[model samples]
Target: MRIYLAAPLFNDIERSFNERLTSLLEPMAHVFLPQRDGKLMRDLVDGGMPLEAARQLVFEADINAIRRCNYIVAVLDGRTIDEGVAFEIGYGRALNKVCLGLKTDDRTLLPSGDNPMIIAGCKKIFANTIELVAWLRGGFLSARDAG
Candidate 1:
């Protein structure tokens, strides 16, 4: 099984979070992290390409990876969920892939008790990593055994 980790990677905290998340999930399945693994954008910018072009490259790469992945693990912890992460989760759900939303933040943003649309799309939502990883690994392994 392969997992697409969708999260904001703009700052050090977000980057570290994504890295740790990938490490935790790597043992159970192949992990495709848009921030860490999307080399095209970094390479393009490093090679002196325009920021807009680099963004496009990164977006396309992530969308393709999301399509190929069997599951999506999205970190929704923040004052508001990242736009890209939300879109990726929605796209993954539209493709019928399992999407797990990880919301570790203590604060809730929406007064409607989280966006019904976003919650509707996720197969499950987890506030902690341990339980989420265990469920993910168990489900994948059980499916493999069944097949």
Candidate 2:
């Protein structure tokens, strides 16, 4: 299976965690980690590419990767879900791809809970990477069947 790991990648802590997660998931499936696999806006800009062109290239690369993947594993940590991650989840759903969530944080905007739309988008929500890995290892027959 090919998995599109959707997560925040703006800072060191987030990027490092994403790499660690990618390593864990690599044994189970081909993981398309944007930080590692796709074009980086910073690098492109530093290399003399215009900001707009770099942004476009990065966006297209990620969108194409998502199109080719079988699943989207979204990291739903932080007080609020990352905006880009939210967009990816919606896009994945629109394309009929399975969406799974990894929510290590307890914070939420709603007094009730995380947004229903977000919750409904995911086939399953894991509390940690271990749980997510375990679920993936089980073959995801239910997820496939649902789709």
Best by lDDT: 2
What's the lDDT of the predicted structure labeled candidate 2? 0.93
- Quote the positional error of residue 144 for candidate 1 in Å: 1.7
Tell me the tens digit of each residue's lDDT in model 2 across 1-147: 899999999999999999999999998789999999999999999999999999999999999999999999999998788988999999999999999999998998788888788899999999999999998987655666778
Q: What is the TM-score of each candidate against the true structure?
A: 0.92, 0.92
The runs of at least 3 residues in candidate 2 whose Cα sits more than 4 Å from the true structure, single-residue gaps closed, are 140-147
* Candidate 2, residue 29: lDDT: 87
The reply for model 1, stretches above 4 Å from the true place, is 40-43
Error of 1 at 43 (Å): 5.7
